[model samples]
Target: MRRWAMQAGLCLALCAGAASAAPAPTWRGLDPDNTLVIDTSQGRIVVEMRPEFAPQSVARVKLLAREGVYDGLLFHRVIDRFVDQTGNPNNRDGGTSSHPNLPPEFDFLLKPDAADAIASRASDGITGFVGATPFSASQLPRPDGTLRAAGAYCAGVVGMGREEDPGTGNSEIFFMREPSRRLDRSYSVWGRVVQGLDVVRTVAIGEPPAHPDRMIKVRVMADLPATERPKLEVMNPRSAAFAALIRKVRAAKGADFSICDIDVPSRSQP
Candidate 1:
């Protein structure tokens, strides 16, 4: 069972600009405490947390993860074209940890990154990244220029799964293998997949999958011993290579480009 039902659909077709060879990218380190290393039955998937969007939700996940509450939890309800749900201790909708429920975090106060990495523009809103998570905000800022909006539910995005009561956001969470734009502004998105999206896509599918896939072990990257920690680096959003990639993509897409089309690149740090 899942805390909330999640759905996926056929992928939307978008133009992918070809990336040309460039100088080695300048790497940015992911905050270990904010990165989740989910080693599933099939493989490992790395999720980068966005505390800026849902600090409480992020805290809840970190607490349970650090406590080993998610180990061996089944991907209880996986939809073929939709989300992969898990993290329910009782494996049911009402299942939760001893911790209290949290209020809904449907949207966050949006602020611009120091880099000029704008991805999309609408009459009133613009989309940009907060550590690889794409979010949109209003052009008409508040009197003080602090706008607010939700992040997009792009494929491979990680979100908090809640039941009927908005405050029931606790243990259960889901990974989006397919984009669910309708979920934007309705669910609390806390992270994005930085690696192993393939592992997420390979989770066995079923309402309650017979012989379902499960997480072998879930750990906050910071909790892992130095010898066990993953060495990875993400492309600096402000890097010239990244900026060039974005320019190529925006130009190739012409008027059809969107934030969803920009896949943030990462690599293992040698």
Candidate 2:
């Protein structure tokens, strides 16, 4: 029965973007150990990660970033009002990484509100789907007879990390092409395009001959000196208030678990 409960918990975490499977461990929070700042010819874009949420994926990116693996990498694929994908060491064919395929880190119930916030949306109220699963909530959950604000899942063009493909994430990543209301609960969003969006908009679209955009280098802004780095302060979810909320929620739910068990929301890139 304990084993079964563990399995059940694992399943729930997978749904929440926490664990990929029973065998793999989950990420803790931002990989301050290996943060990155993407430098494009057009401009620089900063990314703050949450390794606690997806540790394996974050470690994989750090490994690649430190080796300068993504340096001179091309944004091999781009779609207007959509995503730009890269990470193929060769920028040709489906990119392969040194790591093995990872399991899905789903942590659904852990952060329903945040998940809803990032979910993709259509012009109509209807929600979208990915891999045959609906991403966002069409209606709000009211468990105690009280009205709750309608919540959504992650949407829009999100930074893509490998799911079910462990080490497969290496240096490759993708941006959402548009608001993906349906994908809110399905994918793990590592970071966002905080700057140089215009350059991303101007990326050469289409496959091959027309694929002109490329990532010259990717660095972590925090790692740089104050004068050289951009003015940015990533909200540390470890703050006292944030930690208190997690305790309150867990206590209210009558659950005994690590604070890491709660899904902390990601603040939008400024």
Candidate 3:
């Protein structure tokens, strides 16, 4: 009984160590082509869409935004502490662009030539960062030696929506207000909010908000006039400082460490 108690105490201590908060991160400029600006009833939210993981989804979103298809779209479906969903042209639950539905890019295969900074590894899989986005992937190789992985659905993640078939997803999108484990791999995460998360959280919450907030204007950074452009940046997770950050977080979290716990540092200037 005494030995059992001692082991339990030790386990508790280790778990406590694994839950500690990490220090802040360093920063770098964002690529304008990959950046998007959304002005909503709540305020402005800027997202950095990743083409490396979901090129077609990113392209579709970019096409819709540049063409003013998203302007005045309602935050049609919102659920508190979950997601702020919108981009349905009809301002109802279901709508899509004239474009054909897209196949899911729920997870992508990482070739050896891919750029990534691993945070943790196990026999079967690894968790790490790929351009400020956290990802979990298998360590086992495919026939081509590439690894399969999906993004960690942390807060502020932007994902496309589909009602029935995964392929039905087109212009609709949603933003994470909190970490959603179940949504990972079920939805394609194409981008994350680098700034204005507070605004995102403030959006009216309801299955269909009683007074739903609407996107006043949405644009790809490249389409915005120079004067209207907002500059955004994220701390490079692949850098030496980020390596220091990983060590600090890992030491603090111990066995509890997860890539989802690392908040990629960012800044925005309007």
Best by TM-score: 1
Candidate 1 local lDDT, 161-207, one digit each (tens): 99987778889999998888899988899999999888999999998
lDDT of each prediction vs. the true structure? Answer: 0.80, 0.47, 0.81
lDDT of 2: 0.47
What lDDT tens digits, residue by residue, belong to model 2 across residues 34-57?
456777766665555544345655
Winner by lDDT between candidate 3 and candidate 1: 3
Model 1 worst lDDT window (10 residues): 6-15
TM-score of each: 0.87, 0.55, 0.86
Candidate 3 residue-wise lDDT, 215-269, digit = tens = 9999888877888888667887656677778889999999998777777777664
- Candidate 3 ranges with C-alpha deviation above 4 Å: 1-26, 268-270
Pairs in steric clash, model 3: 18-253
Where model 2 places Cα greater than 4 Å from the true spot, the runs are 1-35, 106-157, 161-170, 209-211, 233-270
Better of 2 and 3 by lDDT: 3
RMSD to true structure for each model, in Å: 9.5, 12.3, 8.6
* Top candidate (lDDT): 3
Clash counts per candidate, in order, are: 1, 61, 1
Candidate 1: misplaced stretches above 4 Å? 1-25, 113-116
- In terms of lDDT, model 1 sits at 0.80
